[model samples]
Target: MADTLVADLIVERLERWGVDRVFGYSGDGVNALMGALRRAADRIEFVQARHEENAAFMAVGHAKYTGRVGVVTSTQGPGAVHLLNGLYDAKLDGVPVVAIVGQQNTSVLGSAYMQEIDLLGLVKDVAAQFAQQVSTAEQLPMVLDRAFRAALATGSPAVVIVPHDVQQQPAPEPAQEHGVVTTAPEWRRSQVLPFDADLQAAADVLDAGERVALLVGQGARHARDEVIAVAERLGAGIATSLLGKPFVDESLPFVVGTMGHLGTTASAHLLGHCDTLLIVGSNDPWTEFYPPPGAARAVQIDLDGRNVGNRYPIEVGLVGDAAATLAALLPRLRERTDRGWRDDVERHVRDWHALVEIRALTPADPVNPERVVWELNRRLPADAQVAVDVGSCVYWYARQLQLPAGVPAHLSGTLASMGCSVPYGIAAKLHRPDRPLVALTGDGAMQMTGLAELVTVARMWPRWSDPRFVVCVLHNGDLAEVSWEQREMEGDPRFADSQDLPAFPYAAYADLLGLRGIRVDDPERLGAAWDAALTADRPVVLEVLTDPAVPLLPPFPAGAAKLEQMRTGLQQEGAAGRHAAELLETYAAQEGAGR
Candidate 1:
C-alpha cells in the first residue's frame, strides 16, 4: 500500500468539507502541508498572503458573502500570533472561519524550542474552539472535522493547531479512508406560544395605552412583511437596531429611524412617549436606546429562548422564530383605539427625513459621511454587497446606507478589530463574482489591512473574468471620534480632545499596488469617482479626503464615552495621546455632518 502522509489526510478532509482555496502564508513548520497542497494544486489552490492576519480577514469576508467556511493557515509562533486579531474580528462579527496553524514538534511541546509557543492558550479567547493535533496520522481527520463543525454551527472562527511532527508522519489506512461528516441542526417550525392569549393581552395593552412602538433586529430580516403587518395592525412606530436597519424601508411611514446614539430625535421622542414597546429579533441593550425611565411596558420575541429578556425587564417574552411568531399573532391581534398613532409616527418620520436632508446632506464646509453613504445608496447598484470594517465607517454605513431587498451586508467582530476592509473586499469578489462588491474603510484601518490584499486582488482579477471591487477609504487620518462624546457625558472634560494620526498619501499606496487609484478631497467629486470605479472592469481604489473634523455618528452615548476616553488618554499622555486628541477634535467638529 502507498504511504499516505498525515498532511494528505488533512487536505482530503478540507476538500470533503468543500474548501477549494486557502488564504495563508508558508512557514517551515507547515512545509509538509504545503507540499501536500502542491501535489493537489489542481483541486485546491493555496493563496499565499503577505501576512497571516490578512489571510484570516479574507477568509471572513469570503464566508460572509458566500455562506461557505472560510479557511486560513499559518505557521507557529509569530505567524499564529498575527492571526489572532483577524480571527477575533471574525468571531465577533459572526463569520464562520476555519484556521489551521502549525506548531513545533510534539516531542518538544513543553520545552521552549525555536519558534514554539502555546498557540492553543494564545487563541483561546478569540477562537470558539481550539485543538492541538497530537498525531498527524491518527488524529488528523478527527480534529479537522471537529474544527469545521464548531465554526459552521456557531457562526464563529475555530482554530486547529497542527504540530510539525504529526503533519510529517504517515497516515494509517483508516485515516486515509475517513470522509468528512457534517451535521445540520434541525430547525423546527416556530412554536405558537398561546397566540390568541398573547395577542389579546398585547392588544389590550395597546388599546389602553396612548403611545406604542416597535423595535426590530437581525432576527426580523426574513419577516419584513410580518413586521410591517404587525406595526400597521398595532398602530405602532418602528425603530431598529444597527443590524435591523436594512430589513425595512426607512421611507416607510412607521420608521422613526434608528434608535441609539446615532438615533434621530424623532425616534427618541417616539420611544420616550411609548406606553408599550414590542421587540422583535433584537438583543440591543436598553441602556443604548435610553428609553425614558418607566415610560413603557416591553414585550420581546427571539429565536433563542434565553435572549428574550436577557438584558431588559420584559412584561412578555416569546421564544420562537420572529416571522412565525408575528404571523401567528397577527390574525388574533385586534384593531385598537390608536387611530392616529400611525399618522403621528409617519409625520415624525417625514419631519426627520426633512431634517436629515437639511443637516446630513447640505453641501456644507466639510462633507458629511452620512451624505457619502446616501450618495452611495443612490448610485451603487441595487444589489451591491458592502463589507464594512469597524470604526466610524460602521456607524455611518449602518445608519445611512439603504440596501435593496435580498442584498446583504457583513459586520460584527469578536474584538472590533480594524484593517478588515481590504481582506473583506477580496473575499466578497471571490465568492460573488457577478455582484459589485465594495469595501468601506477608514483611513487608519485601510492603511493597516488594505495594501496587502491589493496585490491578491490584482492576481485574481484575471481568473474571475475581469471581476471588480471598489475600495472606498474615508481618509480622515484619525481614530475614535465618536468615543470623545461619550467621555464628556461621563463628566470627563478632557476626554474629547485626543486620537489622531498623521495623514498619509493613500492614493499613492493604491497606485503602488497597480490598482486604478482616484483621490478626491472635495465631496462633490465623490459621486463621480465612485461611479467611475464601479463601471471599471478591474479593481479600483477611490480615496476620499474627508474632513478630519467630522465626528462619527455614534450609535449610543456609551460608545461616545469610549471615544472621549480614547481622546483624553491621547492628549494627556505621550505621543500616542497627542495623536488621539487630534483625531477627536477632527471628529467632534464634524459630528452630525455624516462623514
Candidate 2:
C-alpha cells in the first residue's frame, strides 16, 4: 500500500475528532485537502459553499445550533480573509469553531507570491486560543490536536494554517487507530456549584432586594427550566438578550420579550423599575439600554468569571454554570410574594402584544412587512430553527416571531452582519436534517450574500422529500433600516435615491434553480403563500413585496436628539412623513399608557 499522504492524516484527525461535515469552497491551495476529503467521504462530508464567508457562517451556525465545534476550510489570502466576518460572529458569541486555512507553498514564505499571506497574523486576535501555521508534516498531529483542544476548552475559534506543499508530504504512522485512542479530550466545564461563600453572597444580594428582574443570554439556553423556576420563586419578571430568546417561554405571564434596541417595551419597562437586576449567562453589551446605572443593585451569574460585571456594574458576581448556580442559590433564598410586580410586567407584555397584533394584521397598499413575519411565525413548525438577518427584517422578526421554547434561532447579534440568515438556514438543516429550517432576510440583505446561497440550498438536499428549508424575502425596494437610520440619526430627508435597489424577482429566481417559489404581494394571500412554502417538496423562497414606508419604531424611548432628528426628517418628506408622524404618535401613546 502507498504511504498515507499528510492530507489523509488531516482528514483522519478530523474524523477522529467527531466532525461529521466540513463547510467550505474549493480552491487551488486546498486542492490536496479537498481530494483527501473526497476519498474520506464516508467518514466526513464536505459541504461546498458559494463563498468562503458563507462557509465560515455555516460553520458558525452549525457550532451554535449543535453545541459542537463547527469546522470550515478556506484557500489562501482572499478566501481566508473572507472568513473573518463569520469568524468574528463566533468570537463575539463565544462558540467553538475550527478554521482550516490552506496556504501557498512554504518556499515563498516572505516573497509575497500569488495568494501568499500571513494566515496566523490575520486571525490571531479573533481566533483567540489557537492560530498556527504547520511547517512540517511530522508536527501536524500535535498541532491539530492542540487546535481542537483550544477550541473545545475555550469555546472559541481555532485556526490551523496548512500550506499546499506540506499537505502533499508523506504522513508518519504508528499513531493508534481512532477506536483504540479512547481517551476523550480534557476540557474544563464551568463549576457546577460555586464556593459556599460565593453562593451565600449571591443569595444575600438577592434577599436584600425588594424587586428583582432576571435576564438571560445564550449561556442559559440549556437551563431554561432552572431559569424559570428561579424567576418564579423570586417573583422576578424575565427578559432575554436577543440571543437568549430560546431561554424564556414566550407563553409565560411574567416573561417579556428580548431586551436591547431590538427588544420589547415590556422588557424595557421591567428593567427600568427593578430594584435588583439578576443577570444569568448574559453580557448584554448595550449600556444605554441597561437600567440607569445606579437605579438597581446588580448580580451576575456566568461560567466564565471574566464576563461577570463586564457589561454593567454588579454587587455580586457568581462564577458557575447558570443551572447549577441558580439551583444552589434557590435553596438559600426566601420566596417573595408578587407584590404587583408580576402583574405590572404582565400588563406591559399584553400592551406590547396588542400593539404588535394591530400592526401585524393591518392591511397596506404594499403588504406590511410585519404581517409577513407574523404569518411565517404562525405557519412555522413549533420546533423549527430560524435564522434572521440584520436590518428592517430583524425589527419585524424580533417583535413578531414568538419563538417557542426549545426552538432555535440564529442572529448576527454583536457583529450585526447581513446576508447571514440563508447560510445559517443551510447549516441548521444540515445539522438537523429532519427539522424545518427558515431564513428571514430583507431585500437588501438577501441581495448582499444570501441570493447566491440559494443555489447551494437547492443542491445540498436533493433527496429530501419535504421542503426542508424556507427563505422568506421581505422585498422592499430600499435598505430600509439604513434609510430609517439616516432620518432618525442624521436628520436627513427620506431619500430613496441612494438606498433604492432593483426589485429582483426572487421567486422566479428560485424557480429557475429547481426550487419552489411563492410570491405574495397582497396581505390577504400572505398566509396561503406561507402555507404553500411550508409544504413544498423542496427548498422554497417566499418573497413578499413589503411596504418601505412603514416605520420600525424603537422599543425603547429615544433621546431628544434622535426624536428631533426624526421629526425634522418627517417634516421634510411627503407621504412617508405623514406615516412616520402617525407611527411616532401611536408609539408615544403606547409608551405613555405602558408606563
Query: Evaluated with TM-score, which candidate comes out highest?
Result: 2
Q: In every candidate, how many clashes are there?
A: 35, 0
Residue-level lDDT of model 2, residues 97-178, one tens digit each, is: 9999999999988998998878888998998688988888777877788888888878788999999999999987545665
| Model 2, C-alpha of 590: deviation from truth (Å) | 4.3
Clashing pairs in 2: none
**What lDDT does the true structure give each of the candidates?**
0.72, 0.84
Tens digits of lDDT, candidate 1, 185-296: 2222334454567656755665565677888887687799999888887888899876677677776767877777656656766776688888888876546464654678
Candidate 2 whole-model C-alpha lDDT, 0 to 1: 0.84
**lDDT for position 338 in model 1:** 50
What TM-score against the true fold does each predicted structure earn?
Answer: 0.83, 0.95
